[model samples]
Target: MISLLKASPAGDAVSALLDCHDRIRSFTALALRLARAHDLAEPEARDAAAAVHRYFSAALPLHARDEEESILPRLRGREPALDAALAVMVREHREHEAAVGRLLAACAAVSARPAELARVAPELEAAALDLERHFDEHLAAEERVLFPALRALLRPEDHQAVLAELRARRT
Candidate 1:
């Protein structure tokens, strides 16, 4: 798990989200390693499964809400060109959630039945790859288009409000 550092100062919403993208990448890589292991024993598989499940379950939803609720609405008025991309992102978030659920179930099953690990490994890899591929472009769009617009257009109060809303969701 990524350790908590200093709290993001007001107006650092974009930076925080970017940091989250990094964590997402890190966790996804870790999950892929765990999933692709050829001989995953019960205890190790359980630990890895728990870690992956905890991260996707906890952090991923908050990240989606940060985009869907806080960031996207603000962008719609200022950057109308982003409407289609935003819509796609919203749909992809739902897809990601479903994928995570399936991956979690498969991983949990492996913990209970170690012999099943080899059979389900491909499913786990597919789900992780799906999320990773989606996020690669999605994060690029946010960094390239959305976040820069937010930084340039948003008032200090707007930043504060977004940061507060994001923190509230986590709590």
Candidate 2:
């Protein structure tokens, strides 16, 4: 089991983003598991729901901003192919935000009343599945295409700027 609370390395913005992706996947999976676990005890259910909620509600938006504000803008117009990939990344970010809202709502419901998991399970499952599907593809694209392109195209100064922005946002 990946420790959801593990900190990503500092200084390397790209590696931090990759670590964030891993956390995203882990939390999404936890949401799915909690949704399906009809017999889970209330305390365990509540803890799991809260964990998922905290990650999506707080960390995710910051990660998106790191890409949109610091990383993507720097990479734009460097290559036509990269430009197209960046567009797709933006579109997918919007989609993920919408899906995350739905998932968070379900998580909030469960967190408020862990005993209500049975009632909220359907919505939670649907939202988690939607996000999982979208994110699986989205993370792949960034890891395979965008990150490599970012490494190739961005200047050392650009990376420093990104690192600063990433750190500043967290602080």
> How many residue pairs clash in each candidate at the backbone level?
0, 0
Q: What is the per-residue lDDT of model 2 for residues 85-129, given as tens digits with 9 covering 90 to 100?
A: 989989989877777988899999999999999999999999999
Task: Report the poorest 10 consecutive residues by lDDT, candidate 2.
Answer: 1-10
- What are the runs in model 2 whose C-alpha is more than 4 Å off? 1-11
lDDT by residue (112-162, candidate 1, tens digit) is 776777788898889888878877887787788777788888887887788
TM-score, prediction 1: 0.85
TM-score of each: 0.85, 0.91
Global lDDT of each candidate: 0.78, 0.85
